[model samples]
Target: MKFISWNVNGLRACLKKGFLDFYQEQKPDFCCLQETKMEQGQADIDLGEGMLEYWNSAEKKGYSGTAVFTPHQPLSVRYGMGKEEHDHEGRLITLEYEKFYLVCCYTPNSQNELKRLDYRMEWEDALREYLMELDKTKPVIYCGDLNVAHREIDLKNPKTNRMNAGFTDQEREKMTTLLSSGFTDTFRFLYPDLEGVYSWWSYRFSARKNNAGWRIDYFIISDRLQNAIKRAEILTQVEGSDHCPVLLELDI
Candidate 1:
């Protein structure tokens, strides 16, 4: 199966920038989007024939949201973590397939000055627990913009970005804790030591032109699915948002 994740930044803007063109070209079995920034019926997105769409929009207007488009229907679908605090942002959606569960999430950012670091920490712990509980039932394919650069190699200016929102020690360690528990960061698992590969670039300072970016987006699978990975990729050339799509191919 082919699964892809991208943080569109804003789906409405991406549509004007050739979102459908790329979607048609890839034709992935599943396409997951983060930071959709709009409510249902706000966009002219038509997956057209043979596909089903699921959306979880934030209660706030034009804010954080997520969606999934898949040709294969899932046995069950869940919106949010079933918690009032986290559910308000529409940051997570889970689709339970026959073989595994696919979760799309837009983890809350710590924000400038780490103003929201406390909330983000709570989210990290809760989300990790949520994922592990799902893993107990079946292997999982968790993908999205997790908002943390797990290692020094994950970002270009690691030294300067050390205390930044996404690269802060506290945030990075949460990712380490999650991975150590039972998940596999698919891209790193497949291409250990691959450098200068990134999924997100800031709009400021010609970041993408200089390849100064971070690999915060990911496709993390249950450790049990390591043998099933056929390919894991960061589609850097595809453009529509600050983040390029990350792809995963599984034998299962």
Candidate 2:
């Protein structure tokens, strides 16, 4: 089955820019969306028939949010990690299928001034614990805007972006910790030698035009699911948001 993930920046705006067209073109078995920046009742999106849509909207309208669209119904669905404060932002949504758990998350950003770095670290710890607990029960297929460029190969100019929020040492280390705990970065597994491949780009400084971008969005699966991953891709040509779509195809 094919699974896809993308941070649409804003669902409303993205729709106008051909979100539906891309969705129809890909026709993935499952699709996870992050940074929707919309709340229930604010806008209506028709995804057509035969697809189940689940949304977790932040309490703050037009902020952080996530949604999952699946052709196969999940056995159960969960929102967040049961943390009252963290749940407010609608950062996480997990769909428990018979075989594996699919988690879509919009990780908290450290912001431009680095004022939220402490909180971001706390989130990292909590999220890691949550994923580990879930992994104990079943293998996981996690995706979305993880908001960190894991290594020097993940971004165009890692040296210049070292102190940046998404490239900070602390943030990257958290990603390392997650990967060390039996999760595989699917894209890297497929294209270890590929360069200048990125999923997200800045609107400022003509970043995308110059191919200055970061591979922040990801499709990470448990180590046990590594062999199941048939293909992993970054659809850089698909435009609508600052971030592009990441695709993963699994035999299961």
Candidate 3:
């Protein structure tokens, strides 16, 4: 199966910026989107035919949200982690298939001066526990804009960006803990020595033009799924949002 995940920034705005064209060209079996910022039916989306759409939009209008488009119907669909504190943002969606659980998440940013760092830490811990529990039933394919640079090599200038919202040691340590607890970061597992490849670029300071980006988006899976990883890549050339899509292909 093929999977593509991108933080479209805003689906409504992205539609006007060639989102449809890119969708048609990629034709992934499943397309997961984050930061949609709009509720379902708010925009008319014609993603060709045979695609089922599932959305989890925030209670607040025009805010954090996630959507998934796929040709295959899931056995069950779950919205959020069932925790009131974390469920309000509409940040997560889990699709259960016979063989695996597919989770698309839009992780919260720690915010300027780490104002939301405490909440973000709570979210990270909760999400990790959720993923691990799900893994016991089926291998999990967790993908989205997780909003953290896991290691120094993941960003353009780690030294200068340390303690920033997405590059803080606290956030990075959480990611490390999750990976250590029986999950695999597919792209890194496949290309351990690769560098300078990133999925998200800051819109400021000509970050994209200068290729100063961060690999915050990811396609992570249960450790047991490592052998099934056929391909993993950060589609840096694709444009529409600040984040480019990350691709993962598995021979399941």
Clashes of each: 0, 0, 0
| TM per prediction | 0.99, 0.98, 0.99
How does candidate 1 score on lDDT? 0.95
The 10-residue segment with the lowest total lDDT in model 3:
42-51
Error of 3 at 24 (Å): 0.9
Off by over 4 Å in 3: none
What's model 2's lDDT at 30? 92
Write model 2 residue lDDT over 20-39, tens digit each, in one string.
Answer: 99999889999999999987
RMSD, one per candidate, in order: 0.7, 1.0, 0.6
Residue range 1-252, candidate 3, lDDT tens digits: 999999999999999999999999999999999999999999889997788999999999899999999999999999999999999998999999999999999999999999999999999999999999999999999999999999888999999999999999999999999999999999999888788999988889999999899999999999999999999999999999999999999998
Error of 3 at 103 (Å): 0.3
lDDT of every model, 2 decimals? 0.95, 0.93, 0.96
lDDT (Cα, 0-100) at 132 in candidate 2: 91
* Pairs clashing within candidate 3: none
After superposition, the stretches of candidate 1 with alpha carbons farther than 4 Å from their true spots are none
| True-vs-predicted CA distance for residue 83, candidate 1, Å | 1.5
